[model samples]
Target: MKRRSLLKLGLGGAVLLGLVGGGMALLKPGLVDKHMSPSARELMRAVALSVMDGLWPAPGAARDAALQAHLDRVDANIGGYPAAVRAELSQLFALLSSSGGRLALIGMSQDWPKASVAEIQELLNELRLSSLDLRQQIYHALRDLNTIAFFTAPEHWASTGYPGPREIP
Candidate 1:
């Protein structure tokens, strides 16, 4: 009787372990795990990092100009993003502008090599805050894509087949 009871207890424990392991497998990221390939995840990370790179402090005009050039290249390649994503990007862009303004203001207070230490420090602080704020905005935008159902349906408009954008005339 004692041996039978012990065997039953061991079996129950194994079953419980199996159930928990299966549950954890199911709990893991479903869509991201199955849908987003490695390349896609890397691309998303690159986009976020590009935004972060823009917010970094640039001391010299040459470095600043180079950063601007890189940004233009990325802009041309990325093209027009979706409307919802664009709105969030715009918010981050505004923060970048604010950081740039601080840099210019601090530049004004001191000479090329020797500037107001306090203003420079303040500019760095502002840039850090701006970067953090932008990170949050980007996260919110990506997280939203997981849940928001943007398109409920679809339609097609063609010439002669339906009333298209061109007009009847």
Candidate 2:
């Protein structure tokens, strides 16, 4: 084993490993272990926009910040769930990330972000009324997460006529 031969072998091994890792990542995008992947986050962001469309009327940066904050809250909540629950949610997110699953579940050939608010509403209604338990469950999960995240924020308290707490220090 000369020095040049050893260097070439090491580089070859690294390249091979990189190729394998990349291939595995492409084949099993659902293998996210700890937190939601970027694709899942994007999907959820689109869902949040559709689900919480009318809740916040602010335009420009205000609306963007609110949506991003809601997503952060939702992500934190999901991170705190038990492993089994997280795994289920991850699987669902992965399925929805795929084109086939999106078409089947959402009944739309277009991307989630590109789907109009009306299209999203229609799909949501279908899911809500679906005979399949999983579809209904997914709808409830997304709806509940979005609603809870939006309403529970302190900034939105005025909308609910909730005055600040009376116990001033």
Candidate 3:
């Protein structure tokens, strides 16, 4: 009876573990890892704003001023940004830098919209995926910075050396 009871308990625990694992897997079937950081967030915003301007050129000077303001905010202090901070920013810039310039070219071209419905859809899908891919890289890089900070706050802060990362926080 004692042996039988132990076996039953062991099996029940295994079943419970399996059920918990399966539930979590089903709950987030397509989970993608992500992180958030100030620099990454700012850089992503800059890229997104650029992309927006590309798709719809701000319509006037006020909008252009706002966009430049945003870009300046992100670019400030970037030369000495921490490695983790730098990595995330660089990854985001790469995505947009490579393809962002030509967005207006494709969008305004007659060949794209005039293509067959399927082709047009494909083009749109490609654009969507590329944007998503860039966003994801930004997210991961930002998240990585956050995680590094959590465990190793001082590693990257030394970039500023004596005055490393503002003490306000």
- Comparison by lDDT, 1 against 3, better one: 3
Per-residue lDDT for 1-169 in model 2, tens only?
9999999998997677556544444565543655668777777777778887777767789888887888788777787889888777766776677776666555668877787878888888899999999789989987887778777889878887988678978
Among these predictions, the greatest lDDT belongs to 2
Which is the leading candidate under TM-score? 2
lDDT of each: 0.38, 0.75, 0.41
TM-score of each: 0.23, 0.74, 0.29
lDDT of 3 at 28: 30
lDDT of 3 at 136: 44
Candidate 3: Cα lDDT at 118: 50
For candidate 2, the 10 contiguous residues with the lowest summed lDDT are 22-31
Instruction: Report the lDDT tens digits of candidate 3 across residue range 1-169.
Output: 6999999998997677456544533343211133323333443443334333233245488656544444344344454476665544444433223222224212423322133435444444455556566434444443343333322334323443534545675
Off-target runs (Cα >4 Å) in candidate 1 are 1-68, 99-169
lDDT at residue 121 of model 2 (Cα atoms): 81
